[model samples]
Target: MELDEAIEKRRSIRGYTKDPVPKELIKELMEAARKAPSATNRQSWRFLIVQDDDMKNRLQEGITQHFVANAPLIIVCCLDRHAFTRQLIEKRVEELIDANVMSREVANMLYQRKLPQKVEETGIPVSAYLDLGIAVEHIVLKATSLGLGSCWVRMFDQERVSEILSLPLEITPVVLLPVGYPAENPSMRPRISMEEIILGFI
Candidate 1:
């Protein structure tokens, strides 16, 4: 399917069939996510695919939306906090410099910027969240292109989910994506006019 078609057809699928999503298709979605760009090329996104009934039930306890458990698969999208540490940021910058994608002067300038010195900081960096968001959107669009349906779910207990998944301290769950065959065909949601969305073209 064409990219524009997929974008138009995509919806927040709240209902799904019982049929399981194929493993190959799941791999394809992950591949699309793998190619997404990230801040400083840290590539800090991580995904945990859950399909087991027991695991799904456990996850449902934390998620307010029970429909998520009905899907055959749920992708736990996460961000690796360690990726934002000063050390890793420097490493990624150096790699860009070596590849000629970034100049030594720019790398030096980046080092001068203030960054999280420790990975254990209470608040995750906004850039880390943006990186994960891009990767997750890749998965969402790829799922649509592959004749599957998905929903981006964020109304959940983060700490509870982290415990249920046994995620390490460095890994933080950001979003939950439920994927399967659509059981309901929802009409397109309302949108603001293009003029309203685009303030001004400089």
Candidate 2:
């Protein structure tokens, strides 16, 4: 299917059939997501495929939307704990000194002090969240093109879901996606016109 067709046809599927989605299709969706761009080329997003029924029920228990339990599979998108960002910042700071753009003392000071505070003070950095978003949408749109249905589950309890999945301290769950063969045919919702959406530039 064409990209525009997939975009227009994509809907939030709340109800799903009992048919199982093939693993090959899931892999294709992940491949599409793997191509998503990230800040500093730091791919800080990790995907956890949840097919265990017990774990899915535990996740659904924390959600008010019971329909999520009906999905044959749920994907947990996670954020990296700034390990790579910290390393990148360090490397760039040193490079700045090597290029004579910054003094060694100044680079050391920034690396020793300010850099450590960024990940801690910022807590779940927005840039990482933004990066994860690009990857997540790739999977969603790819699923649409492949004749599968998916719904983004963002309202679930973050801590609870994290515990249910046994995620590490460095990995934080950002969003959940329920996937299956859609049972309901939802109508397209309205969208703001381009004129209202865009402020100035074409």
Top model number, lDDT: 1
Model 2, 25-138: lDDT tens digits are 989988988899775455778899988888877887667688887799888889866645566666756666677777877766765654443454335657878889999999
lDDT of each: 0.92, 0.81
Q: Model 1: residues >4 Å from true position, as ranges?
A: 114-118, 121-123
> What total of clashing residue pairs does each candidate reach?
0, 0
* lDDT tens readout by residue for model 1, 1-202: 9999999999999999999999999999999999999988999999999999999998888999999988999999998888888998899999999899999988888989887889876357788788889999999999999989999999999999999999998988999999999999999999999999999999
| lDDT for 162 (candidate 2) | 81
Runs of candidate 2 exceeding 4 Å displacement: 82-85, 88-114, 117-122
**C-alpha RMSD between model 2 and the true structure:** 4.7
